[model samples]
Target: MTPQQRARFFDAAAVLFDLDGVLTPTAEIHMRAWSELFTAELARHGVQQQYTDEDYFRYVDGRPRYDGVQAVLQSRGIDLPYGDPSDAAGAETVCGLGNRKNAVFGETLEREGIAPYPGSLAVVDRLGMIGIPAAVVSSSKNARQVLEAAHLLDRFPVIVDGVVAADEGIAGKPAPDLFLTAAERLGVAPSHAIVVEDAVSGVAAGAAGGFALVVGVDRGVGAAALTDAGADVVVSDLAELLPAEAEKDGS
Candidate 1:
């Protein structure tokens, strides 16, 4: 869809947003933590390979942690023990490695904190003005914490994040369950809801969910990659998508 088409779709029903790279400015932090943990883990096994920024967004940005571990390792043609979540952060098991990465991410969160993308927040505020409900679909168990840190928690009333997805056994992005759940919670039909995602897998999920609009937030990824992965519309930031409505209202 073009920006006009996307705007037409958002004129009614709801918008479901991916939390990390879409609403918050912490995608870089996640990429860093994942890179560090995976690098150290591979080193312990004497692999000595590198995990790049390209690797992080492609394999894990919107995914659950354990799933992310599997994805990245699979990308590298390496496999390790599926360690327990209870295992020490440095432990070599997959779960252990994931936990270690979380510890690193938590520390980073504490040190750097969370900041909502100004452009994305503008879009959300616009939705509020238009009386369109919007919620967040996140695969991070820390979604609430991240929102709180960013001080945008109250903006979304229906949150479908990692803990909810795991507890309900709903598959994550590229599967559509989380996004669908958000739409359901918002009492909106799939065709009436829009999904704004910044990750490739997330864009695929929104497409798979049959959302009326799958708007991609091209933070660092090129626009073509997001479109190829199934986004209906791609924008450099949310602000680009909001001015039309503001203009219509003389606001």
Candidate 2:
């Protein structure tokens, strides 16, 4: 759809944002960490093929850590035990590898702090001024940490993240449970909420949940691909959906 056509769908009373790529630029950090971890581990196992950003988008972008590890490994015909979440980072198990990745991500975050995309913050602030509530719906257990680091935690009153999803037995994106849970916690029906996601799996979940609007933020994912995944509208940035007046107000 054209930008004008897409702008009409942003009028929902509630907005649910994906934390990593949509609000913060941590997805690049994540991609880097995943590449390093996978490249080293795969080579350690005598697998010569290099890990690439495509591997991240295809296997890990919207999945919970262990789920992502398993998916990527399985794609390469590698198998590992599904160890418990408490497993140490050094353990050669699925959960351990996930833990290792989490450690790497945490280190990267601490070493180089994070900030919300200016456009995202502008739109989020505008939503509040307009009396529209917003929540965060993400597949990362580190969502809270990332939000806190970026000082964006308080902006979102409800967060349906990987940790909450795991504790509540809600499935991750590509399933509608996580987004549905966020909407439920926000006291809104799916039809009254807008879901802003950058991942294909996430857009699919929003569409499957029958939300009022599924907005795909095209970070690296192409518009056509996001559209095929059920994004009702696709924008290069959230600011694109804001009114000229809101932009001026933010400025």
Candidate 3:
């Protein structure tokens, strides 16, 4: 890493991470689940449109589940009632569709399991060694489950995820509420914390929150897009943020 890049980490009081694409490959699973849900739903309703990765990036990625459902449905000029969270998966309501997607995600996660990215692990390890705190700030209600599946639940003591967000009435990404909540939980000011994310919405949240740095991981999201979304720096992988000495030691 460049000296300037190294200083970004060293000078921060804490690092807040987005859970899915940033730290784990579960993002692919999420994409599949979303595609499955939307494809079937669109056909059933004869919407004459197909769900695609572009839709996922534009309307779903890094946003709260119900919000994503609403956004995608709005894109197709379809409207549904804002159903209760307890609604059945088969119900034709916003929360119901969101619940349906989560069910598919849960099934896939159970079937295939998950693991953390090696580069993300390396970055976390180095942060641990340096005594900088780390927390997770994700829009997924399944953040804890994903972390536990990857055997990383114990690493982050401060997790502000969808469940917590709902319980606390916090807004989701692009509003900065979730990331700001995490920094507060860690007792670090937003100005003293770094935000690491793979979604444009998450990067925008970090920027909106005035974080010390916003590091975007380009997991299929182009570097230029991330930069345009307000990332201070963009790397294809978290390992690229490691210092030269730490990189050699890991090697």
lDDT of each: 0.85, 0.89, 0.93
lDDT of 1 by residue, 1-251 (tens): 36667557558599898988888988888888888887876776667567788778788877888999998888777888897767997777788888888888899999989888877887787788778998989999889989999999999999999899878999987889999999999998999888899988899999999988888989987799899989988888877776565647634
lDDT at position 157, candidate 2 = 89
For candidate 2, what is the lDDT? 0.89
Please list the residue runs of candidate 2 whose C-alpha ends up more than 4 Å from where it truly belongs after superposition: 1-10
Best by lDDT: 3
Arrange candidates, best TM-score first: 3, 2, 1
What TM-score, over all chains together, does every model reach? 0.93, 0.96, 0.97
Model 3: how far residue 248 lies from native, Å: 1.9
- The most accurate candidate by TM-score is 3
Q: Each candidate: RMSD to true structure? A: 2.1, 1.5, 1.0
Candidate 3 residues 1-251, lDDT tens each? 46888777767999999999999999999999999999999988899989999999999999999999999999999989999999999999999999999999999999999999999999988888888999999999999999999999989989999999999899999999899889999998999999999999999999999999999999987899899999999999998888787788993
lDDT score for residue 174 of model 2: 94
How does candidate 2 fare on TM-score? 0.96
Instruction: Give candidate 3's root-mean-square deviation (CA, Å).
Output: 1.0
Least accurate 10 contiguous residues by lDDT in model 2:
1-10
